[model samples]
Target: MTSSAPRRTVLAAALAAAAGAATPSAQAADAARTSEASAPAATPQAAARRSKSLVDYHSWTTTTDWHKGRAQGTGITHGARPGIHIVHPVGTLDYKDPHTGRTTTWDYAVWTSPAHSLKVPATEVIASWNAHTPPATWIAVELRGTYSDGGHTPWYVMGRWTAGDGASDIRRTSVDDQKDGRSSVSTDTFAIDAPAGGLRLTSYQLRLTLHRKPGTPLTPTVWRVGAMGSDLPDRFEVPASRPGQVGRELVVPRYSQEIHKGQYPEYDNGGEAWCSPTSSQMIIEYWGRKPTQQQLSWVNPDYADPQVCHAARHTFDYQYEGCGNWPFNAAYAATYRDLQGIVTRLTSLTDLEHLIHAGLPVITSQSFLKTELDGAGYGTAGHLMTVIGFTKNGDIVANDPASPDNAAVRRIYKRRQFENIWLRTKRYDAKGQVKSGSGGVCYLYFPAKPAPTQHRVLAELGIH
Candidate 1:
């Protein structure tokens, strides 16, 4: 389609004008406070019903979780943030970086998690992680899944990541062209080739390969690793949700992608394709974290919002050649100090309301025709935007990055329109061919230590 939306649309003349846009704890007394703050005012049964069944999220975060994995030259750390790390080199491999065509030898260690059965058989899965990759170190995340029919999938590379973009580090990217006849890896998602055929992913295992310079003590520390498996029903529309937080817009800074259209073409042709990182930057800063001046010094002095450019460069997926890789954007957000990010699916707008109500902004991915979302002006095969809050009438107030300038980035989209466009799994393209929707894929960034209320809400949403 000819449009300005990031990653998936072609540039159009209209884009030049369109560019716009938690807590607590305590012991016995703490228990009472936690219940009061976390439980909805309605009833405990209501809270139970709120737990969704369309999606299942599983992760390995604690030392116990690490021990459950079959480790080869890997060891678990003990502390407030337990993790798996390379204790000894198990082998060596020569990696040829496609982006730079540079070959380098690195020592590596492997940790394979035990198979995790999904609560719901899923048609799609997206993996995410939080890690500290010091200079010359990085980690690769791979997944192997079992189909409901008892067929097994080959180990698929979900991402090859590093927190840094320096010469010593390999370009963080998603493996492309990875597919079997039954399933495929598109960017960062593992999806069944034909869900309508009655095939589903019943279980899966994650494999982490930690890489570092040969003979060096450097090792990547992985704090968290997990995936979200979902099987959302195919629908052209979703049920509308009642507004809960009316007139509660959070003050989030804005940056327009259209304005930086040609700033850094090497990173997916600059801002025209930078919605993922741009949206990520907004939430990263919303939590009081941002790239330091030193980190942003590489950008041309003339470009505005160099931080956005910085974000784009860091979150760029060389293989996919775009910044819209979901897990990469979340990984980029976690690079900021004291922050954690994850890629997950929310079942409804009420899930968003819970986070926004707890003072969190969400970065959501969606695809729609021009007629599907009013005020968008242009249609997109895919796009990313920050859901800042709700309008008095329950509409969505978003920091849409596809605007003409920073001031024009704030937009209020219709509630039912926004929800359907975001939550639906199937939609008709401009040519009327069926295309996949994001199914409520979102990037959630929050502090490592959240307030009690924020913690409660996040836990309620199955994030903790």
Candidate 2:
């Protein structure tokens, strides 16, 4: 019950819970389906041990040492600026296995420079990256000799994650660089956002402390690979001496005009749901800086799941800090009952027979989907979305990430077609409607903070 390593012990107990947890898979078959069963709390320790059994356990490392990859091809060109570059390959590193060896593969991307850039003293700087999802954690990135680290550190931490299906979660910090003598190759996995179809828009960092080390001197790498499995053009046309270099978030729901739109320095979404990152990108542009391509995406593990309708109230609270507890839907709930977030989740959604009490807004999806299905009249299988908010008229207003036009729509349920589409999931409300407005559920996401409509983000890129 009491942990020797408070955080570690806490992590261990959480992990134990994850090992025994299970989540209902929604469209688990669909590549883009967001619906997922919330797994229990996972101890990265156990998952790491079990990963060997679940995955083919491929290692992409080439050296059993702490040797950096050679600078090849065209390193990111910063107009005239420069910086450092760090790469993490995919797959398992069997340091636990006696003869398994280590693996660290290079990003399929080539760079003409390092992973850092120099920002002029006291002057705001601009840092940008390209590619698909970057690493779950990064070791080090250099910018103009000044170093900014990511992942987890002794004091500051990025986050933690569970690797692979059924694999234990790892308590990893992005900035921690603890490489024991032995080494293994990294086997990088590519997400849809990579050099392929679809886009989840990852790779955070545009704000200060934005993380990284300055390479060489008086130089900034304009373009570099910021993604995990792929490459992106880290080009910057601005300079540090020029007077502008900070970005802000957006006030309205907007879309980037291109794959290379400029993004904000800090793309944090804690204020709101997935909108934080999106607004950050927009903020940077509206702040006077030319909008470059940036990455951003929203995740709803369950949208069309019949077993799990809306985001379980327990989940949002548990993950309000971070959804790292997922994979094992209900892990850590019992392990640490006193924790604030934990306590919140436990009481949010209690079942009272037919009515499933929701903590977050639970709108009628079955009804809405049915309406869309009937309106389209003849289409393929329909799906569900999130009910974010409501209009002044008490009309249910929500957002369905799948439907571009899913914003604040009222004319969905027109006929029996509306009723039929929702029937597919069987998650209908007590009255058999897609979204019933009876539960006292917190809307999924609300505007966190207001931005200055007239404010502009100005950035400066100093070459040292």
Candidate 3:
């Protein structure tokens, strides 16, 4: 387990455990609803895996490089004073065509990483980008992992990000890339190869390639490029749930994003895009803090939820084009004095249970239809909700921002249903049928240097 390949082995083991578990349908439901059976215990193997040695996390952004301008490329222009743009090219290329004609030339632009290194052994890799009014174009990312002896992995194609019609909306692409020759799409993690007498990973680099379609008036613009890796610890199993088990519910005031639905039509017209910010607002206020007047001053005075609006504006990723940017939301929480945050995945509600028991609330992501997740009464393409505590019968108590009003935000849902959706190891629909999205993403915010137990968990997960 000392080499880079160990990371993939760990993930494979988790997938194995997931595949082996027999998911009971109707019987499992009867048991949970009847308050009869406790959650199945984790097998010995899974427990051992959960206690494996911890890794570390690091990241680099557009600001990491020394050069502040755009990299060299054709049809490239300085994007909006400090950004990068790929303009449409007017000419065609005849060399590749055989029939009646020539193929149109494509505009290209790139951003290369500096010769930077990491102290800890790196694991998986992930990236996020922001752009405005992107045209029909393809984006390819290349990554390299270097060892102490200078041996490195090839410029592996991290993946391709593409946009067809929407120009200004932000799209958060997951680590699972549409591999185009350089890397395998089957695996999301990357390990630096340690050839015999070679080296261990010490440094890494990233490059972004933008492909703009020819003969279009619109250009593909980029605001920022962020890259990181699979640094979260692998904990495949969660502790069993017990009926009537409850934790001290941290009092987080709730605000309904629905209230701002039509107030700011520009900011994704508000509600659909305000969940992340509203959830952050609740967590920040729970810690006895509030956005300063200056932050809210720009908000329209007539808007009832000014702070929610403030959070949206503050956390919006200009290029990603929305308030749902995960890292951006967590970073916004860090801006409050005496607070620190990181985006990481938890094994299950058992992990959440541990945090809630220790007096911390967690923000988690899940998407479901109204039928799939009972009490919610509606479905979302994707949504963010805060885990406040568990009911005595092991049900979920949450501050669901999707409520129609602030007073209606607190909600309780069946334990099994809630955990299944919140975990995001896979996807589920409104009727509780499995669907497409993967889960395990969460946001954690607390005082700088959390308590020992909390710190140990975060440390093991390679989170801040």
Candidate 4:
């Protein structure tokens, strides 16, 4: 009884990619949207839609050891960079960074699947890196499954195996296979056929839904990313995704206000409004249906932990007393990182609401925050820019649709510079909510099939 599959369409990059945003353009501000809407004009926008700009990117040579990319076997330990929930249904699984001292990332993604009755397939899990070498960089994507009966009965991964990169062709084997290491770039689209269970959309698919392109919001929970190899047929099963329930565009009027003035005199330059919350708000709105106290309870903008203060102290203070778990929560933000590895995920095209529901952090890193501050080329300016996505080269792109003179180039922090700014805060217990005096349990739910919710303080917003 699966709902009709949505129409398929080509997918946009999971992350936003706009560089050189220093000031806000009155005209630009008047035209900008939030979420992926915050990205700077795409390199091709001028040739297409003549879009405005919102974020940027610059690569670096930093490497973080992560568990092996493939989940089918033992985990690989790369230096810790940052990671977030693969997908989301609810409950916060936090993991703070030793560097940021905040939990903004999650090791695994949980779905509300019915144990012994329902089974959800992991769609697409990908990782990209700068290939010091060209043409022959072996791209490896691994899949590993960890089960915990201590928490839920059907929570166990009977047998987690990968079906990409290395496997018999789908014509020979019906299931998906591991992607080839030869095609390791982020832009590469690994192709495969859906097995009997088909595939479930990943948070990545949700990331691309904002645009509502023809083949989008692939309901199979399939990974709508790129392919990078020979067997790669350069194909995609895009679904006809509409703008979900998140209606109307936030910052529309605000952009109008800025554009009318011709420029944002606020930050030494730009004229754009910080469209950060648009996505997050949209998700909440969609989930609310009739609107309730649930949606308004807490807002995690990745600012609650000391890691943020330490990294981007000047941006969001530790004692600012704002959002529940946010970093730069000058006031009214949300923080959701604790446990093992914490990461702040910001996609230029990403909507906060989408990430939240998928269990990802909607905030930017302190290093990233500083880059915006520095990028603005402003002297003594305090602006709030949201983290979008980074490039293979290590550049941190962001959405600062508000900088006037330098708003367009407001923030494009170097990896090192951004990280330096994020290390000034004092540490707090990211794992514990309400001062986290003790530890709690984690659960996996499959849609309306409640997994386990005894200790978690459920928010009215459902799961975002």
Q: What is the Cα-based TM-score of model 3?
A: 0.56
Once superposed on the true structure, which residue ranges of model 3 sit more than 4 Å away at CA? 1-49, 52-245, 428-435
- The number of clashing residue pairs in model 1 is 18
Q: On a 0 to 100 scale, what is the lDDT of residue 133 in model 3?
A: 32
For residues 64-120, what per-residue lDDT tens digits would candidate 4 score against the true structure? 212212222112222322321123222223433222344332123222211111122
Q: In candidate 2, what are the lDDT values of residues 39-139, reduced to their tens digit?
A: 11234643443332211111111121102334432132222213332332222232221112323222222222222222111111112221111223122
- What's model 1's lDDT at 244? 70
Q: Count the backbone clashes (under 3 Å) in each candidate.
A: 18, 125, 14, 153
Q: What is the lDDT of residue 456 in candidate 2?
A: 8
Q: What is the C-alpha RMSD of each candidate to the true structure, in Å?
A: 6.3, 23.0, 13.9, 22.8
TM-score of 1: 0.90
TM-score of each: 0.90, 0.22, 0.56, 0.22
Candidate 1 ranges with C-alpha deviation above 4 Å: 1-43, 50-52
| Candidate closest to the true structure, highest lDDT | 1
lDDT-based ranking = 1, 3, 4, 2
Candidate 3 per-residue lDDT, tens place, 230-258, comes to: 33322222235554336345567788888
Candidate 2 segments exceeding 4 Å error: 1-393, 401-464
Q: Model 2 misses residue 299 by how many Å?
A: 19
